[model samples]
Target: MSIRITGLRGENRIGDGHNHKGRKVTSAPSSIGFYLYGALLLLVCALKIPALVRRPRDTLLRAACLLLLSAGLLMILAAPHSIAGLNRHSGIANVSAPVVYVMTTIFSGASLLLIINWRPAPAEQTRRLTRLCLVLYGAASLAIVLLFWAGDAPVEQRTLFDVHYAGTPCIREMIVLYLGAQGAAMTAASVMCWRWSAKVRGSLRAGLTILAVAYLLIVCFVVMRLCAVAARWTGHDLDFLVDEVSVLLSAPAAVLGALGFALPLAGPRLAETVRAIRQLRQLGPLWRALKDVPTPGAVRVPLSWWRNPPAVLLTGRKTALYDAILALTPHCDPEVRDAAHAAALRAGCGDADAARAAEAAMILVARERQRASPLRPPDATGREVRHAQAQDLITLSRAVTSPLVHHIRDPYMPLQKAANHE
Candidate 1:
């Protein structure tokens, strides 16, 4: 068949099994791609659900869920089997084409809105931009559907729909329509992310940088397909562009885009978990030192976590330590604290270190007295509160092992220390 374009006539020689470069076309990978993509997105949705339920106004997570879901659905529908199924169900040839295009357009707009939300702006301006994106993409999606209805595509195409029907009238226009919308969104997101990356720091900057690269890769895919479609207009075949380059490019782009979106959200939580684990380990000595000081309803179990999350485990440990300390308040000796303070100062300790040493010394004495007395002490006074804050808990915990505190804890050390002070 000969397609006439630009006042010239040439053969439409685009083959079925192979591209212009004589390489085999493979789309089975995209079937696997959708399963993996969908599973990952579902995991993300699960993670966000708790946050969204707690705060119903979490627009960022909502936008991200929409973007990822649309992207996964688009991939699924792009598979040849899925296309065949849709065509069979709808009783329309190549019917999956418009639905896939509409999904891609929705993903494009959702991605742009997500990027816009990442960088804060005035609420009114953000809303206006969001509405504009939705309207523009909505019109394009509607046009794709209308053009599909208007176009003549009796032959169902599982793969290569764009290049396969490049010569057909309305299908040709529909191809350009969807690609144009995708290109515009990618270009806008790429520029916005590149500029935004330079102005931010840490995870946000890294996420934006990765997103910028992913957008460029997506643009490359679009451009390659557009070029092949344009080549068809001149009655030439460059089907290799779509079959080879564009399809290959899409895999990495999708992976990188998912990582880009994930980094900013998951990075902080990851860091906090690490910190909590580290602090919890450092507090082990202090926790064991209070083992004999009975905490009400405390069980003597192994330290290994049984499905306890890091943050929760750390909080519970801190609460238990404080409760044990409060139980020892009646045994606290002021003389022991005073001797530890003088010893710490004489040892060239700063005010903070001296205070921690004194507190540690008194805690050691109180714990020893509680252990030797054979009976439980009364609960703490009503007006008394926890003496240390969360941040100080680690330092105070380590101070239990300090030489100065142990020195002052000696029964005879306080008399000499008091005489020296006088």
Candidate 2:
């Protein structure tokens, strides 16, 4: 009987549906996980809407994210119905199948949009890798979509579709493609994040770490899904197992994807939280410093300074403690410069020829520096002028600067030397 054959197929599709259900008697836990993931997706969408409203420049990215969430939401709704044992009604079957199909299409569209719109960053090699990944995923999705559309049967009527609401071979392929794209995007974002995170201190770094972990989780799930698909295509008869495993994996992957995008937006909040926690432990040091405020301490610093060279000299708190960090122009030992030159040579440079070229380049830079409008010391008559200088020094000390010159400590011995001298 056809009924017997279909039942046998269904049984074979998931090993033992009854046993699977018995293993998890209630779907409540699964439902909760799905709900959480759905909520996260919606929240990300909600966050992006306002961002789009505020910055029109992000229209394309915002639109892509919105489309992604919408497609995911429809799939989530249809997933449970197909996973359940109930026979599809005329209305539900007709509408749900098309919805799933549309969801896959939307996924491909959104991914392509993201790829086409990606802006490259500094590292040309890394950017090329990223672009290549995006292109491969996009091309695969396009191939899958074309196959699905050109196939004899609608994807909904396929045996694979009966096993899960997800589109059959085509849908599975799309899932792999989408996941690959996301993994690549996440990697690229992580690379971009690294350069910026170093400039940030305290809680900001923690937030970035959390995001990186989330991105890694996303990549893991995507890889797992790819493995599952591969296993099925190899005629392993483990389609049921793959489907079940994929169901278990999808929600967490979705949760992590949402978290990765959301947490970075709250970086300032997390930073404040970290700062508050640190302040509690640092209260004693702070109280002591406040207690010693009237001690009239004098800190020694060099009289003349070049801002560029000295900025590199003092590593951490040395410049923080000293009010004015003097940058002495070309005053460092020639041996140190020579060592640096040697290092540069070892890093791919000719001997005297490269050194001469470097010297000529430095000379050109110095000559160009001659054209800069020199800062005139403010007239001390106005309080405003003095206040401006105070603010400027604070800004200079705290700012993140490029590394072109190295800073060195003044070797001259003073009458009183600090115990922590480097």
Q: Which of the numbered candidates is closest to the native, going by highest TM-score?
A: 1
Query: What tens digits encode model 2's per-residue C-alpha lDDT throughout 1-422?
Result: 00000111233224344433344222212334444545666676777776677887663566457555854464454445342322355433223333343444344345334433443334565446545644664565466556444433332322244234234555555445444555565555555455556766654555455545554554554455556456656644444433354445444544554454456557666655565444433333323222222212344444333452322333222332222111111121234335445554665656753343333223222222222312322331232223222332222222212132111111221222313344
Residue-wise C-alpha lDDT for candidate 1, range 1-422, written one tens digit per residue: 00001101111233474544466544343356555656666676678777778878776767777776776566666655566678899998778778888888888888888887768788888878877987898899999999989999997655567888888989899999988888889989999999988888887888889989999988888888899999999988887676555766766787788788779888888878898899899898798897567866655443457687788889888877877777777667667787888888999999889988888888877776766663644653431234532336788889988876777777633354445545
**lDDT per model, in order?**
0.74, 0.40
Give the Å shift of residue 183 in candidate 1: 1.5
Each prediction's RMSD over C-alphas, in Å, is 7.3, 15.6
Q: Where's the lowest-lDDT run of ten residues in candidate 2?
A: 1-10
The parts of candidate 2 lying over 4 Å away from their true place are: 1-36, 47-51, 59-68, 71-75, 82-146, 152-234, 277-422
Per-model TM values vs. the true structure: 0.74, 0.43
